[model samples]
Target: MLIRFKSPVAADVLMLGDNAQQLLRLVGREGQLKGIFEVDDQPHIIELLDAAVAAEAQAAEAAADAGGKAPARPLVSLRQRVWPLREMLHQAHRERVAVVWGV
Candidate 1:
């Protein structure tokens, strides 16, 4: 199965397994596994999510500045900011290793 979440202000998150490779292959590109972790490790997931949010914020600001408009406000709330990472833990493949976040 393939799962996707379209964020209002950031890149979309796509989740899928090897069985779904054919669908991705139709685009003439190979999909790479970026990072995967266990659900029991909350801290690791939190850090990854935080870094993603920060990066999104920075990109939005850069784009806005380049366009001569005010920077876009962060779409993530304080609470929801942590939700995606946590959700990833649950959704991630059990055999995958954790990707630690940079402080």
Candidate 2:
């Protein structure tokens, strides 16, 4: 399943179901099929997502610093995966609009 996140200020963002659910959980909205991120809530949601990404990066860096073996090739980080939705939230906040999905 795929989730389509829509906002008046930006193009819709499509994400894999599990990935989208994880992101929703980050923003304190888990197991929700239909929901909205109000304009006032965008900043806090964005902050939560950003902090999760930052934490992931920090953990990876710490492991490397501890002499852990690196993967043979680079993998797509959560930062990369969540960038579009993050930007969408930013646009929504800037436009003072809400983002909704499964509505």
Candidate closest to the true structure, highest lDDT: 2
lDDT of 1 by residue, 1-103 (tens): 5545332333444544442233223222236333223335535545555665576667777888898776546554433544553454434424344422211
Using TM-score, give the best candidate's number.
2
- Candidate 1 residue pairs in backbone clash: none
* Candidate 1 lDDT trough over 10 residues, lowest sum: 19-28
Assess the local accuracy of residue 99 in candidate 1 as a C-alpha lDDT between 0 and 100. 29
What does each candidate score in C-alpha RMSD? 11.4, 1.7
Give the lDDT of residue 23 in candidate 2: 92
Over the stretch 1-46, how does candidate 2's per-residue lDDT look in tens digits?
Answer: 8899999889999988888998999889999988999999999999
Relative to the true structure, how large is the alpha-carbon lDDT of every model?
A: 0.44, 0.89
RMSD of 2: 1.7
In order of listing, the candidates' clash counts read: 0, 0
